[model samples]
Target: MKQFCSIAEILELYEQYGNEFYSEEITQTSHALQCATLAQESGATDELVVAALLHDVGHLIDLAQHGSDTTAFESDAKHESIGAQSLAKLFSSGVTAPIALHVDAKRWLCATNLLYHDSLSRASAASLILQGGPMTSDEQLRFRSHPQSGFAVKLRNWDDNGKALEPPELNFKKFAPVLERVCLK
Candidate 1:
């Protein structure tokens, strides 16, 4: 796992790769800021809000190594896992677990809610298949058993809808305090 010693280094990582597009519509920064804004507006806790802001940091991290390419997107880069494990060094499960399970949340939704799959964007739809299509009945049961599953689903919703192009109300710099408060030494 990548260890982050300070919020500044994380911010620098964002600066370095945040401009890359996640798909046709959203750049990495836009996805992140939008997700964080959604969490804040929905009255999520400080941990969850920070989790939202940094959920896709792994994508940025991965892109830094490989540059933007379809292979990067197509591979099971397991970005959620990367982000979560890296963050686990600095945060509790309240934050890290949700990030880790967010991909599963999407799978859970696809299994339980038939209509949900229709709502995914083109890129998301493609990624969904790469993410294992949907959960099995057994998978659903085990997934729901996790305490953070609901929160992961919530974050997944934001992650799905967060690919908007408009300027966000709060940018990366605005989340610095929250990052500091939750960041472990």
Candidate 2:
């Protein structure tokens, strides 16, 4: 529901609320930075790096819309959809599509990889139940057919691995150029 007009505005959103705890161990900003760092370190395209950075932005938007209640996480806030739709206003599908599908990628992984479910953090696993457990056969087929699904899977791996307690050396501002480059303008 938030209209992001520029990369600065999006950055400001992170600056404003990103310090909030994402899980017991990491803040939202730290998680984002770590994810983006992983993407960048792996030589992902700028769009994918930016997507990695901003994937959970919907949680911030939901926090703003709901006024600090924990209820957003209590149910399926659909943060992936919320973030992708909002980012789509200012970014191309290359950036937003991976974000949108990342959640489904998680579900798909859980369905396809027996060991994948064990890799999730407790918070992520709890959220997974709220996100409808794992994908059904039909859902997995649909997820596989999506063009962005592969990127989503990669992003999901980064998402899962990004929850480190140590803050990343690179901060959110470091990704500004990447975000600007991937902007729809």
Candidate 3:
């Protein structure tokens, strides 16, 4: 597994690979910044903001593992699980749990909220097939019981809307302090 010993390491990874396209239009960095901005603007906790910032770090990790040949949009990397597990080393459940559950939250939302699936981006809708589509009733019940389900759902919403063509108002550097503050000491 890819290891990140410090916030600087994480930042460096972003600096190096974040320029890659997240969707067809948005770069990974832009997506991250936009998501974090949404979380912050929504008055989310520092941990949630941090989760939003780094929720897709797994994609970066997978890229690093597979090199440039990896087509991120072509397959399911289990990015949510990969990212959450990696981040759990340095952050509490407040952060990692939401990251871990975010994808399942997507499935849950698609199942529970009738309009949610229709609102998904084209790429997201396609990936939903690879992601097992919407959750079944039993799966939805278990997902709702997770302690971080609400936070994960909130993060999923930000993750969906974060794909903006314009530049983000804040950069990764702006989030460094929050990262440090929330890191396990």
lDDT per residue (tens digit) for residues 1-185 in model 1: 58666788889989888888877767888889999988989999999998899888888878877788743457788999988887776788998999999889999999999889888787777888888988999999999999999999999988887877775565689899999898876
TM for every model, in the order presented, reads 0.95, 0.96, 0.96
Pairs in steric clash, model 2: none
lDDT of 2 by residue, 1-185 (tens): 67788888888888888878788777889999999999998999999999999999999888777755674457899999999998877888999999999999999999999899888888888899999999999999999999999999999999999987876476789888888888887
* Model 1 stretches astray by more than 4 angstroms: 70-72
In order, the Cα lDDT scores of the candidates are 0.85, 0.88, 0.89
lDDT of 2: 0.88
Number of colliding residue pairs in model 3: 0
| Candidate 2's TM-score | 0.96
Show how many residue pairs clash in every candidate, following the order shown. 0, 0, 0
Per-residue lDDT over 57-105 for candidate 3, one digit per residue giving the tens place of the 0 to 100 score: 9998987788657654678889888888888778999999999998899
lDDT score for candidate 1 against the true structure: 0.85
